[model samples]
Target: MNGRSIATSAMLYTVTAATLVFIAAPLLVTMSLSVSDTQFVSFPPRGFTLAWYGKVLRDPDFQSALSFSLWLASFATFGALVLGLPAAFALVRFPVPGGAAIRSLLLSPLIFPVLVTGLGLLQLFSMLGWGSVPVNLLIAHILVTSPYVVRTVSASLMLADITLEEAARTLGASRWRTFRRVTLPQIAPGVAAGGLFAFMVSFDNYPVSMWLADAQNDPMPMFIYRKATGVFDPSVATVSTLLIGLAIVVVLILDRLVGLRRAMGM
Candidate 1:
């Protein structure tokens, strides 16, 4: 290669390495601190121990928040799938009137600031006399997460073979049968990806939960925030490390089920 080409390659490698370090430094520090024997969070963590992880795990408040967050994310993901699949099918398969406009409306939640969306939902729910924190949080999470589902599933649908559905229908197979056998299989990866996104987003959400959660029903993110700000200890880092581990496990499962690149719409 020419000197100029070699120089450009070296620069690209340097930039890539710098970018990765910038992103991973905080995560590495948090993971390191989680194992620290120190009472408080510290960098270049002192002698290693897993006691902080045990402490966080044993906390009743943490247990409750983890359970609630899991339940909320599961339901929110289900709701998003139920609503998004149909919306995606309609937009991709049919020549619906002003389909582009409809799509933009459906995805507006992602475009708008989630904090602003949470505040708006808080006002709307208060006005509607919806006093149930769980229900309100579920609805708000679905509102935000459904956009991800719609986008991913729509990408899948656009890439799917319409001729297969048509062939099945021509062979006397019902629409439902064709969809169950052909269309669903084609889009399953996207559905799984969207569900993963929805679950993660809902579980990690703080702004929406902050507006909607009560003392009786705090999600993990809010719980972690309270613990971090109130105590400022390694237990908080332990919780963060655990969450990072959970995300890695979930991604591994998704990769096993449907090749990660395909699931990611690549």
Candidate 2:
């Protein structure tokens, strides 16, 4: 390549590396704090000990929060799959009569701040006589998480060949049958990708949990926030690490299934 082109490419690579480091810095800091033997959060932990990890593992509160986060994330992912898959299909297949508007409406959650969405849902729940903590979490999670599923499934639909679907419909198949027999297979990867994102969104959720979680039984994020605010506890580090570990595991699974690098348009 020409000298100028090479220089530009090198600059871009340097910028990208810097960006990645910036993004990962906080997580690294948290991990460091979690392992610190000092009374306060510190870099270069005074000395490392597995005591905090043991404490976290032994604590019932942490265990419950962990379980609560898992099941809630799983349920939210299921809700996203059920609702988002059909919405995605409709948006892509028709692409008519304000399809863009309809798509926007479905994905409006992405535009709203998470705190606003959670607060809005809390208000709606209070009005509807379903203002319990669990109910609010469920509604908030479903609303926030569905957009990922829609984006994934929609992308997959756009990527796939139109003829494969047309051929299935031509064989005297019901629309549902055609979808099940043809479209489903092609979109499965996208659906799985979306589901993974939904899981992470629900699992890592902060704002919603702060507003909607029960005073007595907060989800993991809320639990972490509480611990962080009340005092510096190294066990909080274990919880943070565990949550991030779950996210990493999900990314690895997605990569194995469909390569997250490709999904990110990289």
Candidate 3:
């Protein structure tokens, strides 16, 4: 390679290394602190211990929040898949009236500020006399996460070959059968990818959950925020490290199931 090309390659590598370091340093520090024996947050451990992790695991409030977050994320993803798949098919296949407007309406949650969405939902629910905390939060999560599923599935459908469905229909297959056997298999990766994204978004969501969450029933993010901001302790770090681990496992599962590049449309 020419000297200029070599210099440019070196510069790009340096920049990429620096960017990774910048992103990873805080997470590394948090993980390090989680094992520190110190009573308070401290950099570079005075000693090492797992007591904080034990404390976090034993905490009833933390357990409650974790359980609620899991259930909420799971159901939100399921609801998003159920609703988003049909919306995607309609938008991609049919020449529905006001198609552009309908697509925009479906995807508005992707652009709207979470705080605004949460506040609006709160007022709307109050007016409708829906006082159930779990139900309200579930609805909010579904609304927010459905856009991801719709966009992913629509992209997958756009790339799928249309002739397969026509061939299936010509060979004595019903519409539902064609979709189930041919169309769905083609878009399964996108659907799974969207579900993963939905689950992650719902799991980490804080601002929306903040407005809708009840006093006794908090999600993991809100619980972590409260612990981190209100009473500073290494226990927060331990819990955060565990959450990071959980996120890593989820990403690995997504990669295994969908292949990361394909999931990202690369």
Tell me which of candidates 2 and 3 scores higher on lDDT: 3
Candidate 3 Cα errors over 4 Å, as ranges: none
Candidate models: Cα lDDT each? 0.94, 0.84, 0.93
Model 3 residue 58 lDDT score: 97
For candidate 1, the lDDT comes to: 0.94
Clashing pairs in 3: none
On lDDT, the stronger of 1 and 2 is: 1
Estimate, for each residue in 1-266, the C-alpha lDDT of model 1 and write its tens digit: 99999999999999999999999999999999999999887778999999988888999998999999999999999999999999999999999999999999999999899999999999999999999999999999999999999999999999999999999999998988998999999899999998899999999999888999999999999999998889898999999999999999999989898876776846
Clashing pairs in 2: none
Question: What RMSD, rounded to one decimal, does every model reach?
Answer: 1.0, 2.0, 1.4
- Tell me which residue pairs clash in candidate 1: none
lDDT of 2 by residue, 125-225 (tens): 77888856776787789899999999989998999788988888888888999899888887777888889889989988988877777866578888888
lDDT of 3 by residue, 55-105 (tens): 999999999999999999999999999999999999999999999999999
In model 1, the runs with Cα more than 4 Å from the true position are none
Ranking by lDDT: 1, 3, 2
